[model samples]
Target: MKKILAALVVLVTIGTGSYSYAASAEKAFARVEKSGTIRCGYFTWQPAFMKDPNTGTLSGINYDFMDKVGHFLGLKIEWAEEVGIGSVTEALGAGRIDVMCASMWPDPAKMFHTEYTLPTYFSAVYAIVRGSDKRFDGNLNSINKPEVKVCGIEGDITANASRAAFPQANFVGLPPTADGSQLILSVVSNKCDVMLGDAPLLIDYSKTAPGKIRKVAGVDPVHVFGEHLLVNKGEHHLKMMLDTAITTLVNSGEMDKVLDGYEGVYGAPEKAFKPLR
Candidate 1:
């Protein structure tokens, strides 16, 4: 009887431990379902996700896309916090936000902490330089030298790609909170000789600072990456939920409508490529 009781106790303890593990694994999805809301952490990225400084109004492609997604899923989306590129995954890991509402480049380093949904669209990263600079006009290899200073937002895709491509070059990294203009400023002020950036972002920035920056002539795009929504790692249920919604929206042409509405408001649509089915 004593041995049997000890065995039963061990069984109960093992079962309890397994249940706890399962509960922890599904915590994010369970919380969202219970609340009927998906709290979002977003970063301001022009037409993708923007906040009007004066009015605090939010309007952008992802904003509309996610809104429609919530409607389809019958869940409310709360734009709970504005997160920086460096801290977005940290927020997810800490359960501070349910997901990142804005579309992001799936940087490999972030994969350990976060999971990405199916891509909604794609963009190209280009090497930007001062308009008058022609040192690397056709010779992309020249820019990889150690003397070249490359500027990029810290913890962003630009910085990651730049580091990978130009391993020998000097890197001038801005804080994750720095805006797009700061990247151009790094080049304008000679703080950096080159900066890698998204094509649309650079195009938009060029309008405000004409003749200040241009993509490297004769060199192809440095990299092209898909734009995807993000959730915490191990949250496969939530990721699949988003993936299905996005795929449905994209297939039904709803995603295109959102992109069409933003055309020329910023230098989008022209630079944004639709995702291939």
Candidate 2:
């Protein structure tokens, strides 16, 4: 008799919890529908969400995704350009933005009141070096050798990883907000030995100054990689909406279509570390 009573309690608890969750989700969805506009956060990261110089319009893989998502929900996209990747989290926390799709990594420390959507894209870290610098033997392991000078973005995971990966090498933290082109220029100009960063961005920069920059083979191991989008936490409806939209995009090959549109600018899209759904 007691066993049956306990089972009944468990079933009741589960049913109540599910119904409560559904109620909250419906409420959030109604709120968004009433608003009629979804404020999306944008950063200046090229080929991700950037302003086109020729047309003065915002267009990129991230922008394209948000546009489709907004359309699907019958909401207009309102752009709120942020200065740096860090600002994307800040804006989301302050309730200034409804969704964040700036290629921002979903760091735990920055996730206060923010939720990460499915990882819509991925890229690996590459060791970008000047063509004349042959110290790196095309192997990332060589970067940790003693006397090697390695530069990474300051206050980022790359900088933190540098100490573990290259305890013997001299690790220099470059300012995080510096443009990708400028970062590569610093290395190409001999201001730094090697620039460690996203492989696609480095590959894109190498095209401008041919013969000056070259990428070292082998990507950063899984432990050191990141992929994500940021949205308001507790917004279950919004989260599900995004998840469904991403899954549809991935399945219909629309994700590839959008990414391919910017392939010329950002290089080939890397495989997602996890399922888009």
- Considering every candidate listed, which one attains the maximal lDDT? 1
Off by over 4 Å in 2: 1-31, 53-55, 106-108, 111-113, 161-164, 218-226, 263-266, 272-277
TM-score on alpha carbons, each prediction: 0.86, 0.75
Window of ten residues with lowest summed lDDT in model 2: 1-10
lDDT of 1 by residue, 1-277 (tens): 2343234334544866653424458567768767888999888777687788999999888899999998878788999898887778788988989989888887988888889999887777788999999999988889999899998888777688889989899998899887667788889899999987776677677778788899899988887778889999888667767887888998898888887886775656433454453
Give me the runs in candidate 1 sitting further than 4 Å from their true place.
1-24, 269-277
lDDT of 2 by residue, 87-181 (tens): 55556656777777666654555566577777676766567788777766546677776677776556445555556667778877677565566
Give the C-alpha miss distance for residue 270 in model 2, angstroms. Answer: 1.9
Error of 1 at 244 (Å): 0.4
> Going through the candidates in order, what is the number of backbone clashes in each?
0, 0
